[model samples]
Target: MRLAGNLLLAVLVLAALAIAATYWRAGQREAAARAAYPPLGQILDVGGVQVHAHVTGAGPDIVLIHGAGGSLRDFTFDLAARLSDRYRVIAFDRPGHGHTDAADTAGRRFDAPRQQAALLQAAARQLDIARPLVVGHSFGGSVALAWALEQPGDTAGVVLLAGATMPWPGTLNASYRINSSLLGGALVVPAITAWVPLPYARQVLAGIFAPQPMPESYPAEFGLPMALRRGLLRANARQVNGLRPHVVEMSGDYPGLEIPVELLHGDADEIVPLHVHSGPLSALLPDAVLTVLPGVGHMPHHAMPDHVTAAVDRVAERAGLR
Candidate 1:
């Protein structure tokens, strides 16, 4: 009995040491990420939260909101620069994902699309962005909808690039289901950030851009290492894991939004299935125009920038902002 107890204690001590080492490694990796890739834009103070805003070009304003698990660098990669000559483009790091601070509210409210919109909207006000056409991709699409829904008068229009609008029928993937849980968040996430190699990001990116070939410059330019940080991993997991309820609530208020919305979704997108999201969303919005890309995947913006910009142009014309 005494020998058995000693063996159990030894195993426990080894396990605890391993866990501590994992956390320490996580902190070191996060620090390295921050040090290597500093914020590429100004970090604005928006009502107590720090917002990272990258502004370029000069014309009617256009706000670019990136999807889940990414920073504003996603836009800075190419689209923002492509549109810069035609419009004053402003790409933002959403709360808790990039450099933007999460909402201080309880219940992890930062995951709520409304909360994210409100925070980014305040930052827009600070920049004096006048009636800008808002563009959101993937998860960011929900934020764009929330922006238009919350403050229609302040928005010129909206463009959703494969937006996750309507609530889906089933549960999210196991990673989101697990990581979003309270126990997984507290225990599993730190281990992930610490031990997971940054190169593994490519495997995940592969799923996001299945039918379409991922651009060679995408991974490093998107700041994948920074996203692998513990805080970001937790924030993204929680946001996506708990997203369905927020979308359901937002869908109820969709009828009240009067702004023109341009939607561009790829038919082949498995990430946020087109039939499940944009297909049903088009029926709800009174002035929504959806352009289905025949063979493109989840990232319509990256796969088809011309079509995406054309939609933005249409919205600008319709909104009388051009």
Candidate 2:
């Protein structure tokens, strides 16, 4: 019995050591990530949450919101610069995604699209962004929709580029399901933060951009390492895993959004399929123009930037900003 007790104690000690090592590694990685990619935008307080915003250029106001698992850097990289020439471009890190502080560490507080929209709108009000042309990519589209729905009078129009605006029939693949769970948060997320290599991230990015290749410089400039921080990974997982229901609720309000809207998607996009989202959204929106890129993927903005710019121009014209 004494020998068995010793073995059990030995196992417990080994397990404890392993967990400690994991946490130490995770912390080191997080520090390295932050040092590598410090916040490029200013931080503002929005209802107890610290929101990160980057504003540039001058003209009519234009707000840019990036998708899940992305920071505002995604926009600041190229699109924001592209739009900045003509419009005062304002980009923000959505709550829990970038430098912005999540109201709850587990990321439940802003899981609802409306919550994200309300918080971002408050930040915009702080910036004095009046009736801006709001642009969103992927999950950010849902938030843009919410902003228009909740404050129609305040928003001039919306531009959804490969947006995840509608609910889908199937469950998200295993990675999202596992990562969003309690067990995943306690064990898996830290491991991923500590050791998920760059190669794997590249692989995932490849998949996200599928047929269309990810720009070689994208990973470094995008701060992929910083995005893999444990808290952020967990937050992204929770927000995306819990998103479908909010989409279902938000979809019902689509027809009521009477503002000028622009929808653009790649026919080949698999992440937020064209058929499932933009295709159907064009018909639902009271005044929307859908632009389908024949052979592009999820990164439609990157793939066909001119088309995206044209769509913005159309929205501006329709909203009488042009």
Candidate 3:
């Protein structure tokens, strides 16, 4: 009986040690991530939330919103910088991603694309951005659509790069499901944040851009560590897991939109299937155009920048910004 009790005590001690270790490591990693990828833009206070906006170049305005688990760095890596030459580019770190704080004081998760669009529009107004061409990738695409639907007069045009438009059929990945839950966010998130290595993060990114080579400089430039921060990880999971229902509701509103939309998607994109999103989206809008790359993957902005650039240029012309 004593031996059994001792064994139980040992198990309790080990579990306690593991929890303590995870907490300590999580703190360390969070600090390191902040130091490694310091905000590259000005933090503007919009309502109660803080938004990070990177503005550059001088021409007609172009706002860029990145996908899930991404920051303005995703655009700055290449697309935003390149576009800046021809347009005034404003890349935003969406609420709950990168340095942007979720402004919902009620502590409600800022997962709905409409909510995100409202926040981003408020931020753009503060920066004096008016009727800019908006570009959204992946999850950002959903936000762009919402922006156009909610305030059609304010958006000049839209460019969707492998945008997530339609309500996808399957459940989110197991990791997103787990981390989105209260218990998982409280426990599993911290554990992953604490113990996940850079290579593992890279592996996940590679999968996102599968069938296409990850740009060699992407890991460093895109700030992988920022995405792994505990708060951001939980926020991303919540947004991703809750996205489908929101998309379903939003998809019905697309037919009423009047703004010009140019969608560039890869036929090989497994992340956001081409047939499911851009394909149907084109048929829904009166002025929408869809371009399918023959053998590209999800990261078309990186894999085929020239095509993306041309699409943006076409939108600019259509919007009379050219």
Ranking by lDDT: 3, 2, 1
TM-score of each: 0.96, 0.97, 0.97
Top-lDDT candidate index: 3
Model 1 lDDT, residue 165, Cα = 85
lDDT of 2 by residue, 1-322 (tens): 9999999999999998988899899999999989999889788887668899999999999999899899899888789888888999999998888898867444447777899898899999999999999999999999889989999988899999999999898889787888889999888999998888888987887788878899899999998888888888877888899999998998899999999999999999988999999988898999998988999999888888888888898899899998
Error of 1 at 118 (Å): 0.6
* Residue 67 lDDT, candidate 1, scale 0-100: 93
Residue pairs with backbone atoms closer than 3 Å in model 3 (clashes):
none
Task: Give me the runs in candidate 1 sitting further than 4 Å from their true place.
Answer: 105-109
Candidate 3 Cα lDDT to native? 0.90
Name the regions of candidate 3 deviating beyond 4 angstroms. Answer: none
Against the true structure, what is every candidate's RMSD? Answer: 1.4, 1.6, 1.2
Q: Which ten residues in a row have the lowest lDDT in candidate 1?
A: 101-110
> Cα lDDT for residue 186, model 2?
82
Model 3, span 1-322: residue lDDT tens: 9999999999999999999999899999999889999989899888778889999999999999999999999899998878888889999998899999965666765678999999989999998998999999999999989888888998899999999989877677898989989889888999988998899889999888889889888999888988888889888888888899998999888888888999999999988999999998899988999999989999999999999989999999999999
